[model samples]
Target: MLAKRIIPCLDVKDGRVVKGKQFIHLRDAGDPVELAMFYNEEGADELVFLDISASSEGRNTMVNVVRSVASQLNIPFTVGGGIHSLENIKALLRAGADKVSLNSSAVKTPELITAGSDFFGRQCIVCAIDAKFDKDSGFYRVYIHGGQKRTEWDAIEWAKKAVSLGAGEILLTSMDRDGEKNGFELNLTRKISESVDVPVIASGGAGKLSDFSDVFIRGEADAALAASVFHYKETSVKQVKAYLKQEGVAIR
Candidate 1:
């Protein structure tokens, strides 16, 4: 069995790390550089940096910030937000990102995923899906442009398509549970994980140690990513990992 991964996310905006309920009403978490280095020292298996506002603002990812945080980490890090082209992918990788994640841009122009994978290899490209429950459709709907724009595409179908197009992994985030701290959306995660052969990183709604275990054990996610809980010192990666280890879940 592969050891499950514990990843800490840095949702950077205006050069500061922030968190909020359902990705709204943002509040400061800390400095991105400081948080990145701390997670590296804390034995975190990986780090994720998202320039949360880039897509909505209609701009490229903040390369300067990416470079600054990348310099502090030895572990693999994935960078995302406002990434729309091959040049953007190259710039981010050059800025020190081991991988680049695409969301709104990919939704708008899915060929970007194919282009990115063909050029950088699928291992270097991640397709991020932000989703929210739809009352009318009674299924999760994909949200793009930093969760500001809604798409008619069903979340599950999009996941499969991304993998078929060479996305190495899926970074699935449940917008309904983001920062709610209730736990991850295991139902949604499991659905996607089962639908896609590539690795899926579960994000949003991690409140306690058990939440991490539940997602890995039941949701079948390869990794669990969280923010506020770790950023505020409310929970530690080691504690989560130890709990998973105790629960008979393979974890490093």
Candidate 2:
């Protein structure tokens, strides 16, 4: 069996890493390059840098930041946000991102997924879904533009469609559970995990060590990504990996 991965996320807005609760009330985390280096030494399986700014200026700013962060890490690195075209993916990949994550742009132009995979291989593309449970529809609804807009697609269907279009991984985040510090949205994670063949990285709602174990075993997630828990000195990646090892969860 492939070992479960533990990843630290850097949500960059203006060339600086930031974190927030449920996608609002943002606060500073730290320098993306500094955090990247710390996590690399701290035993993190991978690092994810998200350009949450999603602006033309921000995208350019992120390229330089990604290059700097990439230089400091020996582990796999993934970058997301403001990725709309094949050229955008190319820029980040050239800047040393192991993979490129897509959300808003993919929703606007589904072909980008196929194009990205065709040019860079499916492994280079990650489809990130920010989902919120819809009581009326009884399904997890996909949110785009940083959870500010709701799409007509259901989270499960979108995951399937993205995989079909050549996305090799699904980055699933529950908007309601984001920064809630409870646990992952198991149902949402499992549904997408089961629906698609690609690896699913469960995001949001990770409050404690047990949450990681639970997401791996119960949610059936291939990996777990967290931000605040790792930032602010709440828990180190080495500590989480040790706990997972003690709990009998395979780790790298």
Candidate 3:
């Protein structure tokens, strides 16, 4: 069996790592480069860097910071935010990104997924979806631009479409649970994981070590991505891995 991946996410803004609830009221977490190198040495399965404000600000990725972070890591890392075209994807890969994640760009032009997959292969493209619950519909609604805009897209349906369009993996974040440190939105995670054949990365709401195990064993996520819990030293990657192993979840 393929061991489940444990990923540390660096949500960046202005060249520094930051975190917030529902993607607002941002607070500084740490320096991206320093945190990334630490995670790399600490047995992180993979690393993800997201220029959290690029799309909303209507600009390109912060390349300098990405280059700095990528240069120090031997582990594979994925870059996202404001990736809108093949050119942008190529630029990021050239700067050392192992994979490129697409969110609002894919929603506006899904053909980008095919283009990216054609140019770089499906495994090189990760489809990131930020979703929130809709009480009226009793279903999750997909959001974009750092959860600032709502689309008509159903979260589950979008996951299926992304896979069909050649997305190799799904990075699903539940806005409702994000930064609350409660626990993962297991039902939403399971829904997308079951709906798609590719890997699904569960993000948001991981408070304790058990949260990680719960998401993998119960939520069925291929990987668990968290920020604050790891950033603030509330938990360590090594500790989380030990707990997951004890709980019978496969890990590297």
Clashes of each: 0, 0, 0
Q: Which candidate tops lDDT?
A: 2
The worst-scoring run of ten residues by lDDT in candidate 3 lies at: 20-29
Instruction: For model 1, give the 10-residue run with minimal summed lDDT.
Output: 20-29
After superposition, candidate 1 runs with Cα above 4 Å error: 19-31, 53-61
Which model, 2 or 3, shows the larger TM-score? 2
Question: Per-residue error at 26 for model 2, in Å?
Answer: 21
Candidate 1 lDDT, tens digit per residue, 24-58?
22233356676777677777999888876644442
lDDT of 3 by residue, 54-131 (tens): 453323436777787788878889998888889988888888888999999999999999999999889999999999
In model 2, the worst 10-residue window by lDDT is 20-29
TM-score of 1: 0.90
* Clashing residue pairs for model 1: none
Q: Once superposed on the true structure, which residue ranges of model 3 sit more than 4 Å away at CA?
A: 19-31, 53-61
* Candidate 2: regions farther than 4 A off: 19-29
Residue 226 miss distance in model 2 (angstroms): 0.4
Number of backbone clashes in candidate 3: 0
Clash pairs (backbone) in predicted model 3? none
Q: How displaced is residue 223 in candidate 2, in Å?
A: 0.4
Q: Model 1, residue 217: what's the lDDT?
A: 84
